[model samples]
Target: MGTPTDEDDGVAVALRDAVRTLTLDSPHNRNALSSRLVTRLYEELDRAEADPGTRAVLLTHTGNTFCAGADLSEASARDAPTDAPLGLAGLLRTLVAFPKPVVARVTGHVRAGGTGLLAACDISVAGPGATFAFTEARIGVAPAVISMPVLPRTDPRAVARYYLTGERFDAREAARIGLVTCAADDPDEALAPVLDGLRRGSPQGLAASKQLVTREVLAAFDRDTDTLAELSARLFASDEAREGMTAFLERREPEWAVRQTPAR
Candidate 1:
């Protein structure tokens, strides 16, 4: 077992036998997706891929919140090149295609892009306290970039409702919708049994199985370029997007021009 290192403030890497554990360390920000942290995460994952000693990877986070999603402050602060880093996107793709088993240990609230991270993993175990939300719509943005990956884990109706409303749901709801494998009172205890089973499996067989599943899913879907383009343009131009960004920076509620009517 390799010792945990403190090189990256938002990530900790440890190797134990054939398994590598990657912990998101930014508890204060709920491990928000900062640019530096994203870069480091990609580097660490790449390293694990190249290392012969590593056979599987486990991703977890510290704090009451697993991940709240992108660093909104950073996103709003940047004047030029508003998109997330290309390397970050590449890392997400790599995670989805990784030959080795990738397990996500979700312990708390996870939202927006955080859910994307969970979806990219091969398997996921969540604590009872865990909650999830698709919050881009609330901020007048679209999750188009991660929609492809998340779609496989959830039902179309659930996606439509959550994507439009940006409402939160509990872990039970997440599991019921197929977004999570299971919800456990004790995540570590629940995962230990599964990990033991995985450890006994043939590495090559596991890798092949993952590849087969991915291939089958990808074959059934065609890229929706029109939808993606529309989302992109809308997010970039929306007044609410601007208001949300500014409100987040100023730590206040966004003043949408049109007030929502109360439900009867």
Candidate 2:
């Protein structure tokens, strides 16, 4: 087995036999999505997909909070940036298109972009305390990127409601909505049994199954790429998003009016 840290510097990739493990390691920011992190993750994912020895990939994170979503700090630091690659969207697309299985082992609050990360995986196993939220609306952003893959995991109506509302949901609720495959008291233990099952399948069979499932889900939706682009543009430009981000940085409640807006 070999583990390599890609150039982007936020993700660590380890390969063992047919399994690859990718860990989000920006604990200082609770594994928040920074441009650097996103770029690195994409690179590593590409590597895993191309590697003939890899059949499955496990996505995990450090700290109690799995992923706090996009690093607002990073966004705030940027000035007049145009045409930056949309990280979350690209990652989700890669996962959905991946021929091999991708598993998520979630163990904390997965908010905003974090929730999207979970939704992108082929299967998700969350710890008992894991909570999820589509929080973009609160910050004046849309869950446009993550929504692409998330739609397949849960009821459309529920996704619409929750995503629009920006409310937090526990693991049980996630499973109920089909966003999670199962919840576990011990994530590592829970994953062992699932990995064992995956190990029984031939790599080619697993890859083919993954491809079929992805195609089936994609066939159901008529994605409006233009609409998503517009929404994301508006989200980044909205006053509510600015206010929500300010509040989060200050560790306080955003003004009530801002809170009412759905961020996801």
Candidate 3:
């Protein structure tokens, strides 16, 4: 394992054989997609892409929650920018279009935009401890931006249920619904053969093969990213979203969610 980068960097790169494992290290916020973390991830990805020795990239996390989605604290700030969805869209596109195979090792909870990250990967292995949800609707926003990557890979019925209900599901369901490639009790052991195969693959063959499978996903990005990102920005800026986000941060139900008693 390679030496980790500065802890503040939010991402750590470890190289073993030809695989570059990029670990999401920002456990402070459950590896949420903050602006800083996203920027750092882009930088690390660029390095891996430019490195000829890197045959594949493995994405994982340091904490129990693989990723909890967007940084609600940042999103709820008074001066928060509304371009988060645009940045997230670009990152997802990068993963989908990456020349080398991008794989995910998810062993914890994933929510909202984090699910997009998993969907964008060419292959993902989820451990027994992994759980996933499309929780955007619960926060008063549609899973619009993530839908670009997710809808192409997941079952339409499963997508509808999760996106609309924001309900959590286990790793097996994730695999069954096409969200993850496989679910395993020992993810690392299961990943060993996959990584070995990737390491032995020719660079040209790997890149070409990835391109074949990613065309549909890339097309979705081209067709819907702009519109979806704009929709996300608009939704995040609305009054209902403000109330929802605030309520979430405050650990209380939003006013709209509170039940009213009938007058006697």
Candidate 4:
């Protein structure tokens, strides 16, 4: 396990036996996937892959929200480029194609691209009350880049329902829809059994097994990633997207949302 870098570095690595747990430490932003965080995550995962002692990788976080999705503040900045989505697409590819089993431990909420990261993991365990939603449509964009990994794992019916509604679903629904491995009152307890099982797999055996399981997912990435990324970037740069992001930052309802009577 490597010593944690400074808080500004955005990710921390802790090794427990053969498992390397990477914590998204940027709680100030609800562990939002900033460019620096994404790059450092890729680097750490790559390092774990190269290390002989590391057999599995765990993606966890340090806040109430597991991840709030892309950094909207960064995206809404007029000076910002569409590079964030491109980088996120690359990170999803890394997680999907990783030779080792990547597990995600979720204790809170996840939204938009965060769901993509969760879907790319080989296994994901969430607390019973943790919530998830695909929020791109609310923000005047589609979940294009994330669809690369998401579409294959999620039930088509569930995808159609949630993608269109942007409704928050609990962990149980996530598990039912094949988006999560399980939901437990105690997520760490739930993960213990999984990790105990994985620890017994041999290095070569695990590598080959991961390859076998991910073959279809890898093919999907290869077949459609560039097209999806382009779609993501185009939507991010659209006028409606700009208004949506601005409305979010200003804590106001977006123009597309109907004004409702304030509840007593």
Candidate 5:
């Protein structure tokens, strides 16, 4: 029932009895959190909430990379000067306050804002080979808006290291730091039990339970998002950030990356 089908295109939506399966299908950009994609995700979540049959939601991706964070292309193209990432912030809020249990099926690697998406989920099961990173630092911006959901789930020391370094960590390390629920060789097998249990719950029971459990997460979003989103937008548009993003897109070391001096 909850299987991939033809409709599994970009932001695929499927119903398996009471479970609403939402797949991120833009593999070209590795499911980058473009404003377009974020908007579609919000709509899907709305659909899931409105449908009484949707007792749970499973958010999965379509390609090797789960999500590569915000579309740098869009942020770099600040020609239009819009509130680019605020939509992403809104999407995260929608996920946090979502009524039903949201599950993330992590297939491969995740980065920056992608980590935030996973953190917002009620449960995230990742495969053994899947890697994770908070990469915004590499581009000269902090993981601002994402920090709302991400910080609450992860260890402070871990966040301090990864948030500043942008280093890739394996799924096991992610699980240890509480970024993921657990790492498994077979994510589907691990998620089966969780899905089965969620499917058995009545709509109101699932909704109320999720609200009660995630009340703190919702509170965090309410209190912190406006300021964080502003910081993210400002950083993304800064001179240094532009240079960092340009260097990344050009496949070269960013200007801020220091050159190694000869050993004394």
Candidate 6:
């Protein structure tokens, strides 16, 4: 766990006026959900949950890409697939069940599992510069583990299109689909009133209010995380997925993307 003074950590934690902000700072990798980053997130959440002075958690990033999803480079280098989805599952569960309100302030690109992080928040405000996509299918994997948080919060039709096609959409479309609370030209301005409301609510009142809405999301986690994690591991270990990941890393089209010739 890093204190506010830890300048070199992937997550920078700071408390101000009852809001504990966790800024993802690994811009080199676009704040990808590497093992270290996930672990730090867990630690910071634990700290915030235990602190009575913290009324809300603000999850944001310090770079142009809020998060680019899982660290594919690390994934490609692994000897065999670990239960990485399980780690992701636990993180999402923590965010969903955290007693304090979890808010997301996004102003950049969010991809793949990053959308899960956004969906798990109680309220999310994205700026005009924010763009989002579910790029898992392009990497030969389904958005399995993230569905627990995403499906309950977003429209099925919209998710189906993004999940299948992996197309990028602007923040406005994301807001329209209920993936975020709103799209604002200036997210910080949009978030001010929301944070004020959160700060005014009694801790008990906020926790109870959050539970009312998050009940079904928590239930989905109870029912699906294990199965989805297993499925995710299986898919990542497949030959086609390996090829797809390799192609992505190499900046080339995967085999499936190439046109097939007809036999005469």
1-264 in candidate 5: lDDT tens per residue?
357533533688888867888888898888998877887887788888888777888998877989999888878986834576677778888888887889999978899899999999999999977899998888889999888888888899999999988999999999999999999999999998999999888777877888887887788888987888889889998999999889888999987788889999
Q: How many backbone clashes does candidate 2 have?
A: 8
Candidate whose TM-score is highest = 3
The number of residue pairs in model 4 that clash at the backbone is 0
Give the number of the best model, judged by lDDT. 6
In the range 73-151, model 2's lDDT, one tens digit per residue, is 8654437243332545666677777877899999888998787778778889998889988988777677876666677
- lDDT-superior candidate, 1 or 6: 6
In model 3, state the lDDT of residue 120.
93
**Model 6 Cα lDDT, one tens digit per residue, 1-264:** 224744445999888889999999998899999989999999899989999989999999988999999999887775744878899999999999999999999999999999999999999999999999999999899999999999998999988999998999999999999999999999989999999999999999999999999999999999998999999998888888999899999999998896669989
Per-residue accuracy of model 3 over 1-264 as CA lDDT, tens digit each: 466633456888888788898999888899999999999989989999999988999999988999999999998887889789999999999999999999999999999989998999999999999999998888898888888889989999988998888899999999999999999999999999999999889999998999899999999999988899999999998888988999999999888875779999
Q: Would you list the rank order by lDDT, best first?
A: 6, 3, 4, 5, 2, 1
Global CA lDDT computed for model 1: 0.76
Worst 10 residues of 5 by lDDT: 1-10
Name the better of 3 and 4 by lDDT: 3
What is the alpha-carbon lDDT for the whole of candidate 3?
A: 0.91
Q: Kindly provide the TM-score of model 3 when superposed on the true structure, using C-alpha atoms.
A: 0.96
Per-residue accuracy of model 1 over 13-36 as CA lDDT, tens digit each: 888867889988897778888887
C-alpha local distance difference test of each model: 0.76, 0.77, 0.91, 0.88, 0.86, 0.92
Which model, 3 or 5, shows the larger lDDT? 3
Q: Candidate 1, clashing residue pairs?
A: none
TM-score of each: 0.88, 0.87, 0.96, 0.94, 0.94, 0.95
Superposition-based RMSD of candidate 1 using all C-alpha atoms, in angstroms = 2.9
Any idea what lDDT model 4 has? 0.88
Better model by TM-score, 1 or 4? 4
